[model samples]
Target: MPAKRKLKLVITLIGLLVLGGGWLIVSAQNHPSSQPAQQTQAKSKPKYRTLTLDELHHDPTLTYCSIIYYTVKHGKIQRWQEVSKVSLGWQIEQYPTNDGFKVLVWPDMNIKKEAKQLQPNWFALTKNDSVTYHSFIIHSFRDDMTATTNLKTIVDQINHDHAAMKVRQMTPKMLIVKHKNSAN
Candidate 1:
């Protein structure tokens, strides 16, 4: 009888220990205590803008733009995409104010010949290139309110400042659209 009682006590103790071990393992798996994560940990993040590639095409004033904003990334731009629509020289973007374009032309004097000769050259560049009527990528909070305004404004401002066209020759008040590169 005493041996049987002793055996039962030992088994109960072992079972309890096994159960406790199992619970600890499960708890550890569910929530690791060693590696803690804070809700307010600081992280470096990149700023992004909503932009459309189309803005460059429609604007009447801009003869050309270089380095327009492509698709935005969640974090800091690690690398530039191959600038699918246009070359690296120019790109389109929307400013919050959309007040106007801030053109940083090299030798600011180029603005004169740039407007006259640049268009024809750029147009020739797109001679047989664009697959679409205009390859535009629009990004906006609402589909209606687009950042397209900025590109046009910037180009217009440049035009107003330079009063030049990429196309060399033109008729009176003729609306000219310069294709920066050949449109396939």
Candidate 2:
């Protein structure tokens, strides 16, 4: 081969090698193996369990509150908002007798911390009434009567367990009660 042709061939081969090396470097950076240990672990472990209806109904120790009313348009039951415990109290007081589907929720305990972590907000509108809450569940009833009935049933059941239990309606839709025994 001519010397000029040989030089051209060498230069082309070098260019191809450089391009191939650059592509490999870029791909390695994007590979899952390239991710930090913490990120890989986080992706594998979920921060919270998805709330389910069965878990909510069966777990009485779980602190939760409900808003009883009938609404013309029903919203997604899974949705949640951030609010102070006090603010929730105020909302209950303000709309004691609204008519719509009943709304029940197990609010998140630390809204700020949960928000910072970028987790889904499932906290109820109320404050943390008990330390036992790990996650929250929210449900909406079809009508006011059904909600009221369920609320009464729940209150009665709680009272049955403790004779000294005093249940008070904070709002037409909200109830706040505590067992007389602190140990309970």
Candidate 3:
């Protein structure tokens, strides 16, 4: 009976040792300093920097920019999709409304047909308000509003008017747009 008890204790200790060792190895691998240089570089390769709206406009090299919307859930990106693509040359018209400015980005003729936002992609940015509100037309009552209502539908699911949106230039061609309100 004593021999059996000794054997059982040994087995339990061995199992615990194995588990502890495995945990250590995993933790070491996950540690930043222990990670390979190549892996670290890969993680930070496409370095994204915040660019002002004025900078985005002044950059003549920028042909066009795509509005990519992403939602983070459980500390992971759950939904990601390209919502709208507007040419850099597209005229940004601002109409003075009673409350704020109705900002409309008119599509350029040279814009690719595939990247066009067929429906009105107008957004409102409030002025002289205590809490600045940003709103955009993200839906249409009629199906005939646009050939592809998918973009609007997707945008509607993710964002609301209360959240503010900002533009960030990635590369000479790529643009990363960040909106405060997202479907988390």
Top candidate (lDDT): 3
Candidate 2 local lDDT, 1-184, one digit each (tens): 9999999999999999999999999999989888799988988985533333343355332223322111111222323333224234422111111221112232332233333443222222222221111123335333222111233333334444342112123233233333332221
Any idea what lDDT model 3 has? 0.38
lDDT of candidates 1 onward, in order = 0.31, 0.34, 0.38
Give the least accurate 10-residue stretch of model 3, judged by summed lDDT: 72-81
Highest-scoring model, TM-score: 3
TM-score, model 1 to reference: 0.25
> What TM-score fits each model?
0.25, 0.25, 0.26
Cα lDDT tens digits for candidate 3, 91-146:
34345666644444444423454755454343443343211212232453532221
Top-down lDDT ranking: 3, 2, 1
Error of 2 at 101 (Å): 22
Candidate 1, residues 1-184: lDDT per residue as tens digits? Answer: 6999999999999999999999988888777454345522323333322223354455422323312221111112222232222212332222111233222212122134444322111111121212111121234233221122223443334344442232112112222223333233
Q: Pairing residues by index, what is the TM-score of model 3?
A: 0.26
Count of backbone collisions in candidate 3: 0
Model 1 root mean square deviation, Cα atoms: 18.5
The segments of candidate 1 whose C-alpha lies over 4 angstroms from its true place after superposition are 32-66, 69-184
Candidate 2 — what's its lDDT?
0.34
Which residue pairs collide in model 3, if any? none
